[model samples]
Target: MAYKKLSEQVQELSNPQRSDLFVKQFREAVREGKFDATFLTERFTMPKTFSRRGAEGTYQRDTRDMLFDVTPDFEAWFEETNEALAQTRRTGNVKPTAENIAAGLVDFKALAEETRRKMQASYEKGQALGKGRSRTSSGGGASKTRSRKK
Candidate 1:
């Protein structure tokens, strides 16, 4: 049987959204000796690119060392990252705060409704304004009188 990498196993066990759960479970397995870290050298890649920066790279020299380190609390990390990302998506803010959301500063639903109402009103106004316009040409529904058959 072919050996599967830790990431491949994780992918099989869970999707992207639940990847953290797999990592947590893997760490717990490591902590309990259910899986030996040293044996995982061939099964897992070492020093993810983001963690490969300078001093941080020293701490994660191998998959075993990386796995042995304390597992992070992903829930808080996810929450903070999500909040930061939402703030980044908002425009024209020197610094976005919770108040910006609470104060209803960016109400997309309300803005969309207002735009729809304006568009409808404009369309109706155009229809009313166009009522006065006349069609100079008519369809070819009426044929010219045919000459009497010889």
Candidate 2:
């Protein structure tokens, strides 16, 4: 079976209903000894960069270069790193220390809201561009020159 990337797995888990299906599949794979921990570890440490073609022949990076792990230790570390960065931004001072890093100071809810707003804006921009192109093409005049006689 082809290995699914961590991002794709996370997207699958995003829906509450799909979570049960994922868990079922995971348990069955574990029982069959088909689960590969190395794949997950590698993906967590260093995810592959993915790009997709965009409008006007442009290419956009579709996946974020962020480490994702389901382990408790990794989860704690991730939260701590985010909290430290948030605190630094709020205080306008960089205090790199174990204590500062350990504090859970980040407001994840606000961050999620901001991200949602940005995504919505980008989606709207794409929609407008698509509509504009169709309108321009539909109203464009055809060439008036006639073909030469064979």
- CA lDDT of every candidate: 0.48, 0.47
TM values, all candidates: 0.25, 0.30
Candidate 2: clashing residue pairs, number = 0
Backbone collision count in every prediction? 0, 0
For residues 91-111, could you state the per-residue lDDT of candidate 2 as single tens digits? 465344556545745455655
Model 1 ranges with Cα > 4 A deviation: 39-150
- In model 2, the Cα lDDT at residue 75 comes to 42
RMSD of candidates 1 onward, in order: 16.7, 20.8
The alpha-carbon lDDT assigned to residue 19 of candidate 2 equals 30
lDDT of 1 at 43: 42
Best by TM-score: 2
